[model samples]
Target: MRTPTCGPLDLAAWLTSDSMANTTSTASEDISELIAVDEQSQDVFVSRSFPQRTGNTLRIGYGGCTTAVMIQAVCKTVQPQYQLFSFLGSFLGPTSIDHKIHCRVARTRDTRSLASRVVYAFQILENGSERVCAQASADFHVPEPALYTYSIPLPTIDGDGPEDEHHAPSARTLLSRGIEDGHITSSSANSYFTNFHLMDQYFDWRHCLTSTSTQTLLSLAPHLPTTHDSKPLTARPQIEYIRLKCRLPTPSANWAALAFYMDGGLSFLPLHLDHKSLEDAGACSTLDFALRVVETRGMDFGAWHLRERRTMAAAGGRTLSEGWVWDGEGRVVATMSQTGILRPRGEGKGRGKL
Candidate 1:
């Protein structure tokens, strides 16, 4: 297998294509960059003009909610004085592309060093029915001199190299290779299944695992450095070195991007380990997503960061999982958690109950 080069990644490229030529947006900016504040309603209207991409198919009014946009709107509502340190979001339902998401944010409490707010994202249907697509509660704090500081030891993973030399196959390339090599099979039943691979194109994931899986698709896991004497971790965490394809300028933007990236494919960690094909079991959909930014500053997306995700449990037709993001220097930047619904393919009608 040849090492794939990391190229520039533009999410807007997926949104703006020959197919979308007829589509126009008052806010033509990328999904990660658009948020309009409405003073009258004390709410924000987020534009979801980005067309949804599923595998090879591109369509409108499809795909999951735009988490980055939700996070951004919440931050924007909170304004600039305080910084986001923690947030939790519940994925109530899918948003409609035909309508702008109405975001209502409220500052519930504020103090000298800390503040808290709740954000509601909903859509009002033509029939005048209101659907709450998602909602989040966040805690923001003023940067204060810390009296204590400590970080968990970073996991030692193989294939450590200078940032430039740590390239891996792009998500598209890996999918193509998976299909060609008979490692991954295609299912036309769900557009979401098709778009799963396409979603990985937004970021670069270089696997740190050096072992073959029992299921044989090369499950993502963390491994100790070759020179380290510590035994390999018995608990398999989906570990990889990740970097965004496009650079987000501010800490808030990066937090939103992290929220977006964190929500991608996490619920499937157990399924990936179980080796059960989606045909046999099913695909997963995020129900709720949460993240805590333990460390706010000095983080750069240009460099690789270790992302370790592990399944907490799976039951009642749902799976719960948690993850941690550690910078290259061994500082833990953020922690995340999520729950998702797992519905088998070809069992029901209409987009697999996400």
Candidate 2:
């Protein structure tokens, strides 16, 4: 990969720009000093700024943008084949783009092959409010020397010549204009994830079922009578449930990979299935999810069908686990594990399919 222009001079210029812009914000009152320079020992630099916000709710937009920029800068310096494997962030208090924010990175380990780092993103509001908007620890694996190699075959797809093939529109396309365009040309009145989604030529995904149908079944099931219309039943009937799965394929890259085993179980029912009526009636939540990386194939982007999905276990308001596999062409490939929380939809929703 090409190196990014992020030397000491470039860093200085970036900080200067930030400092100049800060003069007009409310944070300027609280910021007694602003400074950023390279740290030779760790081969990293620190950027500090002051911010001001009214309440304790950190602005998610500014936080995400700042975090992305900070990560990109550090990665450019470290030059790791870095991928966003996992992210866990929370808003502790209100923050402003102009507030005094300090980004500090520390190298935790450096071996012959791999390196790890911890990043702390701190914010100080004008009202003497301090918060840590994001903190992350990441590990980078060194690239191994290539030797003998083997790979699974790519998946098969019907021929509709590449030019005539009908490609499904991705959520990115449906929501934002291409990155080249600076405006939000698409409708913003959509689901949060759909509005700010990630799309890569590196993977292919397909939906096996509609969200509406799944929601309907989940909503109506609890209301169904345990016994016949008029009969008094001794035992309550068991609820029937189905697992929905999506198939994924690896895109052609040196390393074909996929983020598998996302802990959707936590959010699966409350976020997607549970309804207000059921919550009010004191119905128990369902815990059911399982995913496994089945096979590995050669690095390539090809069509892969979701074979089947079944609930492996469900008990005590907690789903066991879910697994996902990426097929490189025809052979099974990479995998990942993830955990999520169910919450009301924020800004992006119902805009487009993932």
Candidate 3:
């Protein structure tokens, strides 16, 4: 991959240029700090070689490459000209942080209204072997006249900002909801398990199902739900309000951001269905993710998106879940589905802990 000269130092100059003055309404200084060049959240024109990999806890030297980031890298190549309407990606393997990811795009099909492109991501091993980490095919469409449009009703849920004062649910909300759904039990004092939301720094999530009531500090750890005399029902569909900490420039960028957001948390739907905790649930990772853009008429990055995720099926160590993203006004933004692998802990041992 060839590196681009538009680094952070050149960003200010790009923003003040006459070209940008005609594009953005918001001032450069007023822009959200969440914008990153390689991430494609802004309009500053970042290229392929811009750094994407960052530090990871694991010393494998390969940094984490998120599904969303990889998708964004591909979408940016055709942004503005054609907005991404659909994407299907397969995560083949993990890449090291030490090596830069190389994205290769190929135009597969095109017509007057729609176009398709295939993307492949690869990382060079220390031994100089190029390992394929992800492959994706995205369909884009040009703006055209539509005769009719409709969207299914969104489940009743609270959103962030304005009257709500940006109070999205913390990790405690997940534990509370898990308990209410009979999927989680309170952990014993000896259990070192804790809510992971305390470490969250980006998106704010408001879990509508369990947010109506408050939870105690002692109530936050994962525990096995108790059984009833009669067989318990399956876990309810999980719903939450997810909002980005920063805003992006275009609709394509927003969609890319949504891709990143859905890749996380949604995969746990299967564990919720089986009433299992992270420690006992075994190892889990997203194998593939597919997203469809239902309508983009009024998609806004600044507004809170209602994300409703539910498991469709799970068997043979694999799980499938569907997630819907809607804007604050109830306009459906996008629908996402993911397939994940769940290996039950024990049996032997796995690389992923809890």
Candidate 4:
């Protein structure tokens, strides 16, 4: 299948087309570039470039991208010692990629060891109207001695993992590789289940021993969740390796990159476990997210890390997915949770980040 190319200048042309692809640059982007926000005034910030939309051409703005930028914008107003520890937010409405974004930061609280910030993002429309797109509450904390420490062990898996020769820089790389092998159409993006025009340049992901079944979440004994939370196989688990395509200049930039990376495949984790794709669903979109960075010492976006995710629940027109990221040595680095709308087609509901 053929997918259309959209360089930086392709926005105008994309806005006029009847397509489900985003008007996003096909060229790869670094995390710093994607999160770079220009200070407009005391606490307000503006985008240096248009915030990117997800692969879904239906114009679903990437919720993670907005969250990442919000985190960065908040970082600018906080003390250097206080790093982001927690963030809770929701996508307020759909966003247009054709316009720049403006962020307003509110200093909610400030103390010696802790700081709180509330951030709101708005799309600066062509007509000069500003519409609220997303909002988030972030907490920053200075490094402190741990009073107690404990973490679940990484699951053991039986299969060729990401270290094998079959891995690529991103998950979608496998989809494109299919085109090279003539297994899929090389010309049209329409033939694919999802689009990755913008994300292919930001991060690399390597999948490992992916499976879903009863008894074992992946149906493998070694790969069971070792936590006390495990209740006789309640969810499907997926494992992958991830790293940024380029180094982020600051620790704050690295944190934002993790925010973006963790948002992947969340709204559709259920479909993924069913061995299905977006083609099997009417529409899916993340409604809310909560993230907590466990440690502030190792802020390395350029290094490889292990990421594991599981579907916590799916019901009542929404689904929840939880994820954990760990350093190469198996130390827990961060945790992310998302709830989203997922349903069959013909529901008459619109599709996009909201």
| Among all candidates shown, the one with the greatest TM-score | 4
- What C-alpha lDDT do the candidate models reach, one value each? 0.58, 0.32, 0.54, 0.69
Q: Which residue pairs of candidate 1 clash?
A: 55-194, 55-195
Runs off by more than 4 Å, candidate 4: 1-28, 159-161, 166-194, 211-234, 352-354
Clashing pairs for model 3 are 61-97, 62-96, 62-97, 63-96, 63-97, 169-205, 185-223
- Please write out the lDDT profile of model 3 over residues 1-354, one tens digit for every residue: 332221122323322345322222211232122222254333122223322222122322121234454556666656466778888887776544344556656667777777887776665544555566677788988878779777888775445442353344455555555567655465632131322321144566555532212122222332333221133222345666677666677775577567756665556665554445455555676788888887657466567777777777778888888888778777788888888877777767444322
In TM-score terms, candidate 3 sits at 0.69
* Better-scoring candidate (lDDT), 2 or 4: 4
Q: Model 3 segments beyond 4 Å from truth? A: 1-65, 158-199, 211-219, 224-235, 273-275, 352-354
| Residue range 136-223, candidate 4, lDDT tens digits | 8999989988897767787665544555635322344554554565444545433333455455567666656343422122211223
Give all TM-scores, in the order shown.
0.73, 0.39, 0.69, 0.80
RMSD list, candidates in order: 10.0, 14.5, 10.7, 8.0
* RMSD versus native structure for model 1: 10.0
* Tens digits of lDDT, candidate 2, 190-217: 3334422222212233322222212122
Cα lDDT tens digits, model 1, 1-354, are 111122332324423345434345333334344322233345455544432433223232332335566666677756576788888877765554455666667778778778887877666555565566677888998887889788888765555532423333433343455556555554321333344543454566665533222113343211212221243322555666788766666776777667766665566666555544344454466788788888756456656777777777777888888888888778888988888777766766434234
The candidate 1 region of ten consecutive residues with least summed lDDT is: 220-229
Error of 2 at 18 (Å): 23
Q: How close is candidate 1 to the true structure, as a TM-score?
A: 0.73
- Residue 261 error, candidate 1, Å: 0.3
Worst 10 residues of 2 by lDDT: 234-243
